[model samples]
Target: MDLLSDSALMLKVKSGDNHTLGLLYERYKKRLFGFFFQMCKDASLCEDLVQNVFIRVLKYKHTYTEESNFLSWIFKIARNVYYDHFKAAAKNKASDVDELYDLKSSDNVEKEMEQNEKMMLLKKAISKLPDDKKEIILLSKIKGLKHKEIGEVINCSEGNARTRVHRALNDLKDIYLTLEKR
Candidate 1:
């Protein structure tokens, strides 16, 4: 038999077939993990957030509508999960710091070092972005979301989303250049 659509599987999940929820998890796990990892750069935390997203999916399956785009709906949940985590962590602690990415060892040590330096600079630049700008970049550039979809998630018009993404890119470019020059 053919694989069911995400909405179909989700409907199954809504109807009390919990097994279908597993199928939905399997389908979205990688993408959701990538989204979370790019935002926070923490493997362990990303794993937790991805689990939480699936949990929320099961928890709120009844709220999902057939007319809505499944990907957008799930991403909305993912965004809320992230904000909830952020807020909770903020309340528990004064600061939330993310560690830099680890670089792999290679035979060309100089090249590896230079590449790692560039990656570190890029990540730092991205980290410095205001939350709104960073989120737009992650959703549009990193997650490969369309302007319309991004607008839906961010609660803006499509044109506004496009404009915000453009400005964010320009800001990121400036920041990256400044960091590179150091």
Candidate 2:
């Protein structure tokens, strides 16, 4: 299959082309997995969430419009999937340990330890943010979505999205600093 834009791939998927959906999955699985893992801290549940996003895409293919940003649309579905899971899991009191992604081997164990410590603190700081701030930070910084795309995902105006991201980052910095001092 030729390399197509995400929208083109989804347009094909909209027309009942299952192969295109697989292509989309291959393109986005890691990103979706990372996003969910960061939010939920569970490898197995994040994997399930990634699969659920694809299932949702297939189920709601008809709702995708040519003008819609695929990143925003897909992430919005992912966000809903996560929130739905969170609600159910909350009712069940489910929680789990932090999921580790494959880390490149370092020649220096001390350096690796320091890096891991910083990462742990950052994750804790992110977790401390309000849900809206956390979602904005995840969408803007972690997922690399532009404010315009984030606005679509968050259902806000572009300017509002930009402001939200700025606030979230500032809040993150404050939280990280506070945690670093601990």
Score each candidate by Cα lDDT.
Answer: 0.82, 0.84
TM accuracy, model 2: 0.80
Q: Which regions of candidate 1 fall more than 4 Å away from where they truly are?
A: 91-99, 102-117, 142-144
What tens-digit string does per-residue lDDT give for candidate 2 at 1-182? 58999999999999989778988999999999988876767789899999999999999999999998899999999999989987876543223224443345566789787897788777667667777787777788745589888888878899999999899899999999999998
Model 1 CA lDDT for position 132? 67
Q: Write out the backbone clash pairs for model 2.
A: none
lDDT of the structure predicted as candidate 2 = 0.84
- What does the lDDT come to for candidate 1? 0.82
User: Which tens-of-lDDT digit does each residue in 22-116 have in candidate 1?
Assistant: 88898889998988877777789999999999999989988988886788788889999988998887532222323455556667788788887
